[model samples]
Target: MIKNKLIILSLIGLSFISCNLKNGKIENIRKGELNPTVELIKVEEKKFILDSNTAPQPQYTQLYQDSSYKRKFTFLNTYTNSIYIYDYETAEYIREISYDKEGPNGIQRPMGYLIKNLDSIYIFDQLTNSLILSNDDGKVKNKISLIGDKDPKNTEWSLSYPQYYPLTVAPLIETTQELLFTGMYAWAIPDSLLEKFHFTSRIDLSSSKVSFGHGYPATLYGSEFNWDDPIYTAVYSDLHPDGNKLIYSFPVSHDLYLANLDSSLYKTFYGGSNFAGTISSLEEKKSSPSHAEMGVHIAGTDLYGGIKYDKYRKVYYRFLRNAMSDVSKDSNWKEKPLSVIIMDKDFNYLGETNIGTLKNYNWENSFVSKEGLNIEYLHENDINEVYLSLHIFVPEEI
Candidate 1:
């Protein structure tokens, strides 16, 4: 009787699987009507190559150019929570600053930036929720806490609110004497209220003040899904060369929005439909007969992003991973190739490039610097043993 019952259960499971296979069909979710084929223009060989072993595991690097277009300095963020300053003209590591000790908060994840005046360096500590200002000698001069209880509705008043998560910082852009920086306040709200969610603020370096700013409400669009559940998301913004416009990406809607401090016009580009399949019904259909969400999975589920405006090409270099295409029945999930997409400033589709077959690979962060396009991915020669690898891609032409 037991054997018969087991057979019956096995048959029922197979029947359910077959039914789901028929109903849950995979669909392609990438955006843009124009599927323009982008041909890789091989202009020149790799002119500069920095092996990972030689330098500190480079998390981020920025190339500073003088008014004459000559490279001045290369500021590097090292894995050791220290900022390494290299004089490009001298081709040497001139100084290193350690912000980990002096501040009230610990410096676990340090994102470094050289201020416009070229005198001070700002390090954003992802672990401590604070910003550390230092000099060329690595001495901490000032510290700013990004988190506070100040309510935007009551800007004049201040309160005490407990910070739950660490802060992520962006590079500071200058206008005249004042410097500007952007960051997000990580918090949770009801799914129904996600659309009204604007958990970010702007900081003025001179006054040492932070002002709450508005952000794209992604929860309004994906109301049916669980927006509260932490999925992959990032908030990234860049200042135009002239500092007139700030271009930023909000992953929830998979859209790029432009904000002009001068005009106060905050508009989203491409109607927030640049990338395909940011939202999926797979989680909702887990018990359903059809696994429709399977189609949206490309390779990685995270919304890892690196965006830059290419003046020469007149295009925006935006890179992110697609959903995992292959789902494994085995307990272990394996790595696959990543899809890199390039688009115009207006979010028009240019073309897609596939970085073929990377093993034990996980992407952390990416950025566009004066040196070229740099991406940091967790990679392993053997499956299971993974380490961070920083890859730099230079444009074919000089």
Candidate 2:
């Protein structure tokens, strides 16, 4: 069984005005005075047959649209160090990109990856502490060290690994001349750095120079907060389709932060869920809690996860983890309640709908498509090792 603590934290915004569909009629509804309902868009079940006979782990999957506008997904089979590709709607096997475990083109440990295109597949090799840019043919074109020359004396910050989500924020994003991603740091970092820590890191693809900016919201800093737990400081972001803006969602705040990549300008909007309140509270302590303890604490707390934009619907989907009544079983914490807050293109709050829980779903294996949000679904007794099942959901009128 996949650990809920790890997948739940990652695997993981907006506004709007507009119209509402009620009883099959279009009605004018002001924002903040409406409730959104969940509509079953469709379901897809596709099996991936591999020659090696090893099943692909759904936890490390990414869904992307090709140049031809066809939807496809890639799965990382760490067991074989291969990535399996499949058609999103049909589940047809496309091909597999296998990499060597050792050599000039080899990748030691791939913790996360992003696909800019078929020709530009970015993989984060944790063992080497570098990012490897490869192609669908499994040929490494470029390798860049994530760690640039920084003062060893500065305990304020460091880039150890890339933190990202497959559905919303990609691990590695290539812009005009720079690649952007968030970093994963150890919890033992100094508190002073936490006060004004930058939330993003940029690597100049040409110069290989690294820089950090887009500091966390003021709410994340200050003496009132504790940085001992990764859950409290967990942040997820995505580069806007516009190519110059970045959207950030904090685990504790209800407001979605929009920052301009070209400058230090940012604005916040109220895009919280009515079912649950914004702002999370934690115990005042110095040490961190066990994984099981953290899971239980999170189940009974209201926190946000990833915020993804649905270019197809012209809206944003922000996930909210509702507090659970029974935190007795941390093992099944994923079975707790969960919902999504919808916002318009302008970041106006539309409404929200409860989509049940992560009980049978792989949170990291979800992506946005024309059909809506496609989340990988699994049955309790599911034994099919080759095929993937997805449940699609979209916001609808009550």
Candidate number with greatest TM-score: 2
- How many steric overlaps are in each model, in order? 12, 10
lDDT by residue for model 2 (120-189), tens = 8888776666678898888899887655533324432254333433332334566888888765333433
lDDT of 2: 0.64
- Looking at model 1, residue 67 earns an lDDT score of 50
TM-score of each: 0.65, 0.80
lDDT of 1 by residue, 40-127 (tens): 2322112122334234234455556645665644445444455544555445555555555434434556655654434466666544
Best by lDDT: 2
TM-score of 2: 0.80
